[model samples]
Target chain A: MIPNLIFILVFLFASVLFYFKVRTIAHDINLGKPVEIRDNRLMRWMHMLKVAIGQSKMISRPVAATMHIFVYVGFIIVNIEMLEILVDGVSGSHRFFSFLGGLYPVLISAFEVFGIAVVTGCIIFLSRRNIIRLKRFWSSEMTLWPRSDANIILITEILLMSAILTMNATDGILQARSNQHYPVVGSFLLSGFLQPLFSGLPDSTLIFIERFCWWFHITGVLAFLNYIPYSKHFHVFLSFPNVYYSKLEPQGKIAHMPSITKEIKVMLSGNIDYNAEGSAGEIGQFGSKDCRDFTWKVLMDSYTCTECGRCTSSCPANITGKKLSPRKVVMDMRDRLEYLGRNIRKHGKEFKDDKSLLDLVTSEELWACTTCNACAIECPVNIDPVAMIIEMRRYLVMEKAAAPAELNAIFSNIENNGAPWQFSNEDRLLWADNLEIKTN
Target chain B: MDRKKIEIPVMADLFARGKKPEFLFWVGCAGAFDDRYKKVVKAFTKILVHLDVSFAVLGKEESCTGDPARRAGNEMLYQMQALRNIEIFNAYEVKKIITICPHCYNIFRNEYPDLGGKYEVVSYVQLLNAKLEEGKLKLSSELFSGISVTYHDPCYLGRANNIFDEPRLILNSLTGNFVEMRRNRRFALCCGAGGAQMFKEAEKGDKEVFIERTEDALRTGAKIIATACPFCMTMLTDGIKYKNREEEIKNWDIAELIAQSLDL
Candidate 1:
């Protein structure tokens, strides 16, 4: 009973700490962005409801959806099992779930059915991932933890659930031998098969084994709770904010370019003080080389990505033989930011000037983007890769002047001639001259 | 021969009557410059005149609206052009305007508002349909016999401004055999003319977007491919030639059909 109380206190304390740690990380990443409250209140609410509660966006692919649904439902239904574990720890009794006469049986049966559902779902999921080898389900950035952790968690859950069923059956048999009324016939039937092995065992041995299984289940759940913030399983909490704070603007509106003309004027006038705030360093308008250049919202978007390849599949530029995959762009940026953040956290002042990590992204990949919003539109998590691309382009154009030659020519043509075409305005009226029409 | 004198005469006539029209008919760069569209513009003008709706033209003073400049990413030139047009309109006290070209209509109605310019803008088809509904203009049925036509919804008019039904209404009133392309209205494909692609050569793709759209119109099996935008008409006409299907398919602006149906 004392151990059970300690377990409850430890679990509650760990969960609260993990929640705050994730919240702080999310908050720090999203600090500078303008708050994007969508204009349509009802539409926002509906989208939130569909994405957060329904898991509608994550279920886009069949195999991944099935696997995720099992894990998700297992996490939910297993809470009742968690209560049983806690109660067992408190009372030192294996029949903790059987407290309320008929109610206990009903609850046990419900959990048993859900456990079977979860096991079958996870089995299908594992087979699909390992055997079928679906390319879309594979993430280049999948960490070691979730990959192995998921398998371990699933196996442990199944074993724990099976052990609970076995314990109940064994208890039913013991109860029947002692002449106590057992509620479930299936429990008695299950116990009948195990009665021969248990007949020779002492009562104290059964009690010790039941207590061992209860402790194992309780510890497994507590460990999972502590591990949530440190792992990719953090997406469970992050998905809600990711869906709610989606970009409200039309996809076509690219990130606003900084007014370089005003800055250039001030710089040339030798009044560096006046233009100090807006002046670019010697690198010029090149492109985003590091995480600091990314908008705060983009950094948030990076962490929120489920590594779903829906963005990659729908991207027009990627389909058209371009090196630009919007999914890779976000993932690569996230990788670079994480790498840089790790270095900054560890080495601090010593690695302040270390530009080697900035080479994580290439200039070609940055320039190849068409700024099409297909990635943003198809992204179930509302990750705006287009916004990130535009920010990178802004840096390339303003800081480095390193944009493609074709784009420069286009700008020049618009500058010198009134139109993109060099055609003489004298001949503009030629198409209208011979028509049999009255002038306005 | 006096260009300025020629421009202000229509405005002078409006001033002489001590009354200003609701809109000045801004016959845009395409309407004033494209030969095929000029006839359509003239037909629209005739309809307005017959309906006794007062309007004036800017004549030679009206240049390009800089939609071509803006779409090509030269915001400076676009701003200059837009500012110049706004000044001229403000000077004339033109509170409302109508344009025949959807590109011009979109620039004037939608884009110009962003540059501190605002005016009630209408497409000619909208004005024409309203006039028709008011019974101010009448049409003869001789233009309709054996004329199987289909309306190609220009992307700017349909998708950009949501002006789908006005053109369809005019076509329906003019001819009974107006078929629709498989992708019509909002889903209408671009004729590869928008975003300044009309002035420049098309980018190399697996298939020409213009040709693809033209073939869609051709597949409708209509003799006449009717459109409301001058750019669509020109591109679709060129697309027909490129596909070697010009003999099988012909392009006509909606106003031209309406003009042909007019008793005059």
Candidate 2:
């Protein structure tokens, strides 16, 4: 009863902490304007199911997908065992679902199998990062902290899996000894291999090991739950909703500025009517200057980034060794959001700062994008770094008139010559000017 | 000035005569102006006439489709330009459009609809593929059997619009020796000319994007590089020139290849 009371208190404390962290993230996201991504509910659900739930896009790279699917599936399936653990924790019972007789062992054994898969997947990923050193992991934006964050998560999973197997192994030996507490649960397929090693231990020591493993596993899970909100692993939760809310248009379409369109139309119509139907949203600024200026979907995209560098790797500019990396752009945006969140916490939502997102994302990086949609297509979770890049470009071009000189010339040419060059529209048929061709 | 000129019907003139063509040929900014891409326009128009497909050019009545302006982040200019072009289209009651440049095709099909300009837009490759499948057009294929050709997937046509099969179908039917680069379809690399990069010099990088893409094309061991987009044509042509592969490798628009192979 005492242990059960302690378990309840710990669980409550962890739950409260996790709730507060999630609330802060939601608050940060709410600081931005709403994006109209709610259209086509059926299509959105289909996309979400295919990309996030089914992990279909992850399979584009089969080797990584194989390892990732194992880890992803294991993370979810093993957590089912959490239900039994929670029941046992609160009720002061051993294998609380053991009353199911034949079915109970099968479930526990399946979880043990998943735990083993998780360890194998994590080890493979760890080696890829640490030993084999995949180039994506070592990219510029993956600084010491980000690198350590990934390694820590992988190591934590492996350690957690080991603890589960150890706990099961010790419990099996205790049950063999016919202890009063350790029930004769069915043999766990993976963890049963460790039982012979602990067979020589006395009943009292086995009981201590079993109780210690139980507490450790429960505490570890609670800590991991809180840690997710702070780590890149937040994608594990956000990828589902992010994919659901992803852009469904043809990939070529840069979102048209409806507000700008209204302004242009009003000017074009020569102001015949003093009042016109302008855009519903405020056309106060041309483009994004800060996190709050970005759409909520863009903010959510930054948060959903796994920092996997798939977007960066496939980027044409990045491939040619340009300064722009899509992964870095996303990470910087997320960092900026965290900074804003902290500022709002400290000095309230009205807090102002001189630093803008532009301070981190340079104009050169913005200009380097070919707008080829490679980065968007390559992202497993559908995080569109291009949206932020183009949004910032709008800010530079419209707000400050700070576009590159050549682009300025091109714009003016299109405005006057009806082309992107200095050629005359009267000579538009220059291609056919000196050629004989059959015509209808 | 020794070359002879031929008459191409302008939409305004046709409209004045109370005639409407089945399709509007959107001779984009590049098609009308860029010398290299001008040939692409002629070649494609040649095929349209060869198939006796009724099409009319807007000629001087046409203007920028606001693709470059939109991509360069000048939304006001893009909207103004787009609004003007839409007025012309509406005036002529254009029902269908055939766009040779993928950038123009993308903007016309995907973006112009948001600004109340909607029409059935087809890329030239899609039209060619349709004609090929419908048996309206035929290529002997024997004329280019020994000439190894590889296709460079224009990003706007491929990844942007998911148009990987149409161009391949056209090329496969035309060239019996067609091969794919290592990165094809959704994974194709961009020519250095997108996002207003054609007008401006490249940003600081270890190498030019076109040079890297040219290296990919060279690796395929195909002598003829077939392109669909006008911008891709210019960039790849420059890439071939820069690598001094001009004497060995030729970058031709897919329309030119079809026109040549069909003995037109």
Candidate 3:
């Protein structure tokens, strides 16, 4: 009874701590400006179902897709068994669901099968990342912690699955011996094979092993739940909502500010005196300088990136040896947002950080993008990294006047000649002058 | 050689004579200034006249649609150019527009609507396909017999605007046998002229993007490298020269192929 009370209090404390951590993340993302992706309700739901739940985009690369699906299904389906574990912990009983009679053994056997699969999948993924050194996983952005965080998730999952299997095997042996509080049951196929190893153990030691395994499994799960927000593994929770609110417009269409459009309308109406007043007051700044200048969806996109490096692998600029890695752009945004979140939490609402997202992602990286939409297309979670890059580039040119020399010349040419060339409007018809076609 | 007579009316001239034509032919910056692209402009104009499409040119009144400016992050300059063109277009009450350049087609069709300059715009490839569907233009299938051609998709027309089928439809109507590069349609590589990269030298790289894309075209062994956008024409032409295969493979715009096939 005392142990059960301790278990309940610990579980409650973990849940409360996890809730506050998630709330803090929500607050950080809410700092971004408003964007209207709220419409198209049915389409958004369909997109989530297709991309996230169905894993439609994952299959583009067959090997990774197959291996990932095993881990995915195992993680999701095995959570049903987790509920029984939770109940057993709270009630201080062993094999609490064994009351279901025939159904209980079937469920345990299925859990054993999935547990083996999960371990297999995790091992393969860890080996691929650490041993094989796949080019996608070894990009410049995958520095020490990012690399280790992935390994940690995989290793923790393996240990958790192993603990569950060991607990079931030892408990099965003890039940067969008619030990106190151990109910006899049919063999769980995979766990039953391991029963021979614990056959000679005394009852007290066997009970202790079962109890240790149960505690380890539940505590590991709680720890993993808390660690997710600080890890790139946050995609496990964010990918669903991220894919749901994805942009439906044609890929090349940049977001035009209606506020800017209204200002342009007044400027073109010939009522505003440009030379006398010198400028339109409301015309204001054009693009994003910091995280707050970005749209809320863009903030969500940064959180959704899996750091899988698929975008960087497909990027033309990255492939051509440019310093622009699309994956790095997303990681930098998240790092800056985390920095600002930490600042506000420590120093109250009035705190200002001297650093900005520009310090994280450089001007060289911003200028290297071709705006090809390849990164956005390749992202499994539909994260639009190029959209964020374009917004930053907008800030560079509009506010800082930091465009390259050739672009500045083109801008001047367009301002004066109404074209990207040096030719005047009077010379526009010169191409057709000597042609034999009839002209009026 | 006797030049075929064709009638091209300026938008201002038609508006002064109390005449509003069916469409405004947007002669983009390349069609107006680039020397080699001028021939492509003439070929497209010849096809439009032969089909009896009532189109008028903005001529000196037409300014650049400022696609390069918007792409280069010059929002202020882009807006100024867009607003100036919008004012001219609304003054004449222009309703429909056609252009042979994909950059102009994309800007007019996609970008202009956001700037309050809404007009029905179509590229020459789309226009030619629509004319054929409407029975307004006819093709002589025997015009170019036994010629193998591979079509290169311009990034703006194919991926950006989703006009993949229109170009293929026009290609199918010609007499030449059509083949595809390994990467075609949505997965097609860019010709490296987009996003104002054509204005400056390519950033330091192992190989130029166009050269990479051209190598894919050459592997197909097509005699003619077909293009729709002048930018693709120039890039692929340069790519062929770089590979020293200019004598073996020639870049032909889709409009030039259509005009020749129609015997216009």
Q: Which candidate gets the maximum DockQ versus the true structure?
A: 2
For residue A440, give model 3's deviation from the true position in Å.
25
Q: Model 1, stretches more than 4 Å misplaced?
A: A1-24, A31-43, A50-234, A257-289, A346-363, A424-431, A434-440, B1-264
Chain B TM-score list for all models: 0.90, 0.97, 0.96
C-alpha lDDT of residue A123 in model 2: 96
Which candidate has the highest TM-score of all?
Answer: 2
A16, model 1: CA deviation in Å? 6.3
Candidate 3 docking class: acceptable
TM-score of chain A of 1: 0.74
Pairs of residues clashing in candidate 2: none
List lDDT for all candidates, in order.
0.63, 0.88, 0.83
Tens digits of per-residue lDDT for model 3 on A1-440?
A: 99899889889988999999998889888878887777999988998999999998887678788888888899887878889888988998778888899888889999889989899999999999989999989888889989998999899999999999999999898889888788776678899888889989899999999989989999989888998888888999999999998877666677775655656666777667644443455556788888878888899898888798888987767776777899999999988888887788888877787778999899888877776666777788999987888788788988899988888888888778877779888988777765564333
lDDT (C-alpha) at residue A296 in model 1 = 69
Determine which window of 10 residues in candidate 2 chain A has minimal summed lDDT.
Answer: A273-282
Q: Give the proportion of true interface contacts each model preserves, from 0 to 1.
A: 0.04, 0.75, 0.43
Cα deviation at A7, candidate 2, in Å, is 0.7
What does candidate 3's lDDT look like per residue over B1-264, in tens digits?
456555468999999999999989998989988888988998898887877789899989888787887777777677778888999999889999998888888888888888889999978888899998998888765866677788888877876778889887777778558899987876677777777777876677677778888998999999889998878888899999999998878898888887777655
lDDT of 1 by residue, A176-259 (tens): 556333333334323245556666666666555545655666666667666655544555666777776665543433333234
